[model samples]
Target chain A: MLILIVEDEKELALSIRDYLKGIQDITCDLAPNFSKAVELTELYSYDCLIVDLGLPDGDGLEIIKKVKTEDAQTGIIIISARDTLDDRLKGLNIGADDYLTKPFHLSELQARIASVLRRIRFDGKSILKEGVLEVDTVQRKIKVNGKEPDLTKSEFNILEYLITNKNKVVTKASIAEHILGEYSDMYSSYDFVYTHIKNLRKKLVELGCPDYIKTVYGTGYIFETA
Target chain B: MNLLTKTSLLITTVALTVLMAGGVIFFLSTKEMINKQVDKELISEMHFVMRSFDNLVHGRDTVFYEELTIIPTDEIISPVARFRDTIRLNVFDNKYHTYRALFFGFRKGGNNYKIEIFKSLIDSNTLIERVTLVWIGMSLFLIVAIYFLNKLIFKSTWKDFFEILKLAKSYDLKKPHKKVLLKESEINEFASLNTVITQLLERVERDFNNQKELTANTSHELQTPLSIIRMKAELLLQTPDLTSEQVRLISDILATTDRLSRLNKSLLTISKIENNQFRETEKISLHEKIRSLAGQFKELIDEKGLKISMTLEETTIEIHPLLADLLLVNLLGNAILHNPVENGRILLELKNNILKIANTGDHIELDKENIFHRYFRQSKNPGSTGIGLSIVKKICEYYDIDLDYRYRNNLHTFILDLSSLYTS
Candidate 1:
């Protein structure tokens, strides 16, 4: 998959570029300004674009609008520091597939990018599989080696969020945000996140799946298959 | 009373006093003048009779009253005249009428004789009554006319005052220029008032915008650096191999960065709210809101083994929905954040128009001095930005809701009186 990251901040753009390039199967390009973003979107036929809503030259929503008309199949994800609902709606309304707030885990951004790509190319499949653990999101079912695991709804959600952003550190707040809302980043408490994560790990271990969920000691949870 | 009414009262009091006093003085003086005329005529007749005393002595005796009898007195060293007021029977209607009479004593044909002369005073009485009636009618008309005149005159004269008032009331702080809203009054007092008010509003608006600018610039400028630090710490976590202590230290760094990011966002949110930037409002259910947040925090509640009771009735309020959600999150999130880890109790009740939230927490009172201040934390957690309650207070202030705090027996209660915001 080819992706374009349109962010003005040099360090943030470079970090995101490096992270995406290191994904092994994906190629990423960086644009530091709105004109460059427009120029790149016009010249290339990328599978997806990651945008920041606030850019020095122009708004990132304008780029989403420009690309959406040219190639409707290309997925777009908006990452912004202005996390208000109004800003989120505007990005979505302008044909962006997903939105992420800033100071977010790059892992969360990666998960959102993956989901957008899957929706475009994978026949919009709701099922996610990490090794022998498989989840049918539409049916809310979890299966392990042709057998189902007795996971509660809350436990299932936590597992799904963790596995989607696999191999990257996802904050407990991010997990809580998935369960709660965008405001959960501010309102998160450690105790509740630990309870959910603990139950999810216990359920997975009982089902004979590899212990994929790792705690980042005071940071958050990470799901990996190494 | 309003200015017009007050002025009319003072003017009317002075006017009535002067008119009433003038009427009394005129009535008395007019009566004296009439009496003088009557006395002069009586004295002239006495003079005519005295000059023609021989006539009264011989032929003019019939000019006296029908029952008059001349009396001789030894005490008449000189001729004397006196007047007295009396009631005399009206011959035509037999109603007693007021009469003022003059008596003159003189020596006639060597005998001291006295003659009493009276003119019926019915006309005088009628004249006095007519004068009094006119005076009373004029007093009422004069007072009433003065009130109405003041009402009409001041209303137009003070149009500029009302305009200034409206300008002051409707000035929007977010709008850059407001000098055009108020006009210079032609009246000196109001013009001075206009100048002073304009200067004051300009000063206040400048101060307010400076504060907003400082908050916005601080938050926005800090975001990129904070983002860089946070992303760098997050990137360092993906290191190939690190000791346990290194991982723990990096994790703490990440957590601190994350907390700092949230603090920046909170300051920005507060600045926007204080600027009244969120003018959009919608009707939303309070009960559903609290229920949804409770569901979100259920895990946290269970983790602490806290007992939370929520009794929500069906009620809705017209508010900026985002603000409403923030209010719920901060208040309830604080409840969860501050609850004791063991046997913590939280009760949320929506009774009447008040949202009463009580929780079991520190036995001693939280710092009451800076409880609602930003960054003045009450919890042991050093990461507390203390912006949560301040945000709650700001939202409450925006909606004009009354927020009260009470602590009793180790239970702190927050009551929000959104009484008037209820629509159903």
Candidate 2:
């Protein structure tokens, strides 16, 4: 999938590009200004656009509007430093697919992008299959060898987030956020994460599945299908 | 007293004092002049009676002698005349009338004879009394007239002042309001007062806007660098050949960056809240909000082996939904975070529109004064951002909820008086 990243900050843009470069299907094009973004969008069609609201030349909302007017099918994500509800609502109202505030985890961003892409491309029904595991995104069900395992809502969310960023280290903080939403910071200890992951591993292992989830000591857990 | 009443009272008092003094002086002076006129008339009557006696003796003039008297004395008195006041019965009116009398000795027909001439002072005394009565009446009228007139003038003159007071009383810094215009005043003092007030309000507004912009810019400027650092650290952790020490260091970097980001976000939230951006409100049930929050934190609570007992009533509050959520989250989060690790107790009670969250924690009391201040950390826990309670306090203040903390029986209790929500 060809995507465009429009951000004025050079280092942040490069980091996002480098991070997404690890994904097999994502090809990112960077634009440092609003004019360049508009120029690129006019020159070539893209699968998605990551637009920053505060650009040096003009507003990123203009690009979102232009793209939306031209092709309503193209997904657009707004990454803004403004975390106000008004801005979030406005961006969503302007046909943007998702909104992420600045200082977001790159893995979280990747997961959101994947979700947005899945939504726009598949029209809701999407499934994932690994060696012995299958995930029905629409049904929120996980299967191993055609047998489903009982998973709680939080565990299911965590599994989806891990699987979406499969083969990459996902922090405990990100998983906590995924499960608990914005109030995840209220947890003084991440021992709950440890327990959920342990239960998940046990359930999967009991289903005759190999241990695909690896612990990166001092960092987080990574789901590896490699 | 208010300015108008006090000024009127002062004017009345001064007028009463001056008028009373003038009335007394006027009465005394008019009486003195009347007495002097009576004395002059008495002396003239004495002269006229003496001339009449001489004329009668010399056969020259005839004058009325009703007010005159003649008395014979054995010895000749001094030729000088003596005048005095006396009261005598009069045959004409059958009433005792005060008289101004003069007695003199003169030789007539070779014998010493004394002439006594007196005039009645009844008219003069009556005139003096009448003049005094009039003076008293006029003085009272003038005093009352000046008092009421001064009151009327003061009320009209202070209209601009009262308007300024109303403007100041109605001005609220947090709420958006109409432009405050000071009406033009004919009084120089009130005009200058309006000018000063306007300048002061402008300065306060300017400072407020500057602080708001600073907060916005600071947060905006900080987020990008923080994200870059976090991304770099995450990328470094992804390196295949990195040792355990390197990964740990990168994780540490990421953790600090995350903490900084959270801190910045909290400050921004505080600034936004103070700027009154979240003015929209809705009805929210505390029982449901608490139950949901507890359910979300159930895993953490269970993992810590803590017991949470909730005794929530059917309490509802009118507040901004987002603030309501944050207030409960922060309070509940603080309770859970500070509770003892094993066998800790948390009691959540909402009775009489007051929420009390008591938890088993440290044996000591936290600083009550500075507890709600930003960055006041009560513990050395690495995960405690020290801003959660501050956010709770800010939300409580926004809603006019009274918050108090007490430490008793090894339980740190945070009492939130949510009764204000209902009253408003």
Q: Which stretches of candidate 1 lie over 4 Å from their true place?
A: A123-127, A185-188, B1-184, B365-370
- How do the residues B301-412 of candidate 2 rate in per-residue lDDT, one tens digit apiece? 8888999999998888888887887888888888888888878999999999999999998888999998898889878877788888998988887777899999999999
What would the per-residue lDDT of candidate 1 be over residues A53-108, giving only the tens digit for each residue?
88998999999999999999999999988877899898899999998888777766
Best by lDDT: 2
lDDT over C-alpha atoms for residue A209 of model 2: 88
What is the TM-score, restricted to chain A, for candidate 1? 0.87
**Can you list the residue pairs that collide in candidate 2?**
none
- Per-candidate local distance difference test: 0.80, 0.85
Model 1 Cα lDDT, one tens digit per residue, B329-413: 8898888878888989999999777898899998977766678888878776653678899999888877879998989988988
* CA deviation > 4 Å runs, candidate 2: A43-45, A68-74, A120-130, A133-136, A144-147, A206-210, A224-226, B52-123, B178-188, B243-245, B279-290, B305-320, B342-373, B376-424
State the TM-score of the second chain for every model: 0.68, 0.80
Report lDDT (Cα) of residue B182, candidate 2: 78
